[model samples]
Target: MRMIQRRIRERGEREIPARLIGELVMEALRDLDPVAYVRFASVYRRFEDVDAFSVEIARMKEAEVPGGGDDPNRGD
Candidate 1:
């Protein structure tokens, strides 16, 4: 992760492919413990502010909504 960050910083404005980043993350996570994955994701996703983290969580919750509503039991 630090290597990726350093690469980006050293090569400013260069485009890094999403697939490459995803592959790198997956490889890194494969050897990491669950808690380490969470820690890495929190920083990697730039959840520095509470609102940013809240927005990401809300997006996840919304995706879980089958029919897109406040109902708890509905699957679709």
Candidate 2:
């Protein structure tokens, strides 16, 4: 977590690669309780609008579906 903060501070507005950050965060949360991961994700995502939040939720739901491409609202 300190490393993430340090990188952000040094990089200014240059965003950390999302995949790399997600891996790091997941590793860090490995030992945490379920609720802790939710808390961390909420803050890390800095969600500001319903549309953005809903997109993520939809992605998660899609991943969990039996047939991954079975989304009714697939095309946007």
Candidate 3:
């Protein structure tokens, strides 16, 4: 939470973009907890169909491949 606050402060903007906040949350969860990240992302992005979930799962799988996923800290 403090990290996010610091980021907002550093931006020096009165209004923070929703995308920035989503990225921050995603980055934090993706490193610390992938499952939670995915879950949160689904809700944050408001996935109302199975297709959306599939796409996200595919992305995760792609990341699982060698040198694919951006974050090396992700667990199997």
TM-score of 2: 0.41
The positional error of residue 26 in candidate 2, measured at the CA in angstroms, is 4.5
Q: Candidate 2 — worst ten consecutive residues by lDDT sum?
A: 30-39
lDDT of 1 by residue, 1-76 (tens): 7866765567576788776676567446635554464455567776778787566556555655676557767553
**CA lDDT, every model vs. true structure:** 0.62, 0.63, 0.84
Q: Candidate 3: give the clashing pairs.
A: 63-69
Q: Across residues 7-42, which tens digit of lDDT does each residue of candidate 3 receive? A: 889999999998999899887887788789889989
| Reference-based TM-score, model 1 | 0.41
Query: lDDT score, residue 29, model 1?
Result: 62
- TM-score (C-alpha, index-matched) for candidate 3: 0.69
Cα deviation at 70, candidate 1, in Å, is 4.0
